[model samples]
Target: MGEDIGLWGVPLAIIGGAIRVSTPFLFVSLGECLTERSGRINLGLEGTLVFGAMSAYAIAYETGSPWLGVLAAMIAGTIFGLLHGWICSLPKVNDIAIGIALMLFGMGLAFFFGKSFIQPVAPDLPAISFGFWSDYPQVQAALKVNILFLIGIAASLGLWWMLRNTKIGLRIRVVGDSTDAARAMGLRPNVVKLLSTAAGGAFAGVGGAYLSLYYPGSWNEGISSGQGLMAVALVIFARWNPIYCFWAALLFGGAGALGPALQSVGVTQGYYLFYAAPYVLTLVVMIFTSSAAKTMTGAPAELSITK
Candidate 1:
């Protein structure tokens, strides 16, 4: 470890850390992008993310299968989305308020039910090594990429493509841009938003799976560190573009890795401050994207926040 830390430490750690940390951001933002495109905001996704982590870890511990745990998390997230959607569809309900309530509820439930999983050993997901091409052990370890990360990349690209070309994507965009137009076209805006929100929740659940089943590789209440909420801001910064979300995830991941990367390079002092890198980046993004006119340039017309 000491030998590897001399000159290559920060870069190597950043590379490895970026891959590990960016994954959840990638997933959550993508999920939020999908939901927002349908004109609903599921702030409850934070709760969905936490609940998914608890469910994933617990199920993985009990079933001895990490993938099964991931599936369970997805299902749980979908349920949360369904509930949020149902409530939001009712007259005069606030999606933002509903999201906050669900976030607290999910956190409470995760802490209550995840007690047994605190000490249990859950299975880990697989990784593909690109480090074999290198001779160093640390290099090999650092270059070992989690399969889920790769899947996130694929999902980002696929989502971007679908939004530009697919029929389902067109419907979602239409509902987002104008409810009246959708109704005129004989499309059900509520149904579209509901299903999109559910899909968003499922993606967040997979992100939770990546948390426990891969990096950090354990079940814990504080594992998410507000990634789900931060993702909402990330989606905004990316202008609700799925392709941009991918790049934004990478940038956030690199910020998150800054502290550890510096520590690895013998910069032990104030290392803890680096953990705030992502949050700092988030603040900066929000500031630059904010407008004095109280307008969101790229936002969908039907979104309550934009109105």
Candidate 2:
């Protein structure tokens, strides 16, 4: 009985760690969900996220308001998205290649701008307390949840509802399913994809903002460790569903924290391997969820990757 109880503690700790660390991934994955649902992919979201983080940190340091930093990050993200969208809309420009280019550009821009602002002090976002009811200190610590996590959950629900129950959602799906069909229905496919990609970029940007302004509260080249790229993979695994993206992001987040968690428990032998857990899980999930045959059977027929 004692051994079983001790083993159960690990799962609970992982869940808590997941919630703590998964917020950035959740925002980015949800953003990718919207972009991919419109039959486009924005690999530049990696750049958007890093730049947003730097922008948020800089803005918050200057303004002394974390919320203001968040708003600035969104605006910056929108601009980045717009750039990607505009470039991709041009004929003879492959969106995938363009996305890669934008990503490199964005990363370079972030590192350049972030150099001068590395040590600036900024206001941090406040956490909402729900642990007052807990008697044990460990329980209270475990239950300390951030308001951003709640916001992420609410955003996921809202996105899911919009995609499933709105006319705009229908248009987006139609455009993704078949551009010819959308044209027949009098909808502009390019316009829809552009808007979706822009919106997704904004969301990803905000996710990046959260990292710099709230989680770490400083800027550096190592601020974002491929959360943006993993988020792209997460969208595929979630099948372009915002709600599923939330869960998948959380799972990845937990995987990310496993190394630190093990270190906390004094087990540091395979720390690097633990750090790779999220990527490994992502590859395995992608293989299982996105086989060529399965895609042919169920994916949106017009999706370029599937085709």
Number of the predicted model whose TM-score against the real structure is largest: 1
Off by over 4 Å in 2: 1-9, 296-298
* 192-222: candidate 2 lDDT, tens digit per residue: 9999989988898889888987675577898
Off by over 4 Å in 1: 293-295
**lDDT for each candidate structure:** 0.90, 0.82
TM-score of every model versus the real structure: 0.97, 0.93
Clashing pairs in 2: none
- Candidate 2 weakest ten by summed lDDT: 1-10
Q: Write model 1 residue lDDT over 1-307, tens digit each, in one string.
A: 4365486867888888998999999999999999999999888888898899999999999999989999999999999888888899999999999999998998899999998889989999999999999888768877899999999999999999998899999999999999999999999999999999999999998998889889889988899999999999899888899989999999999999999888777887899999999999989878777766545767888887787
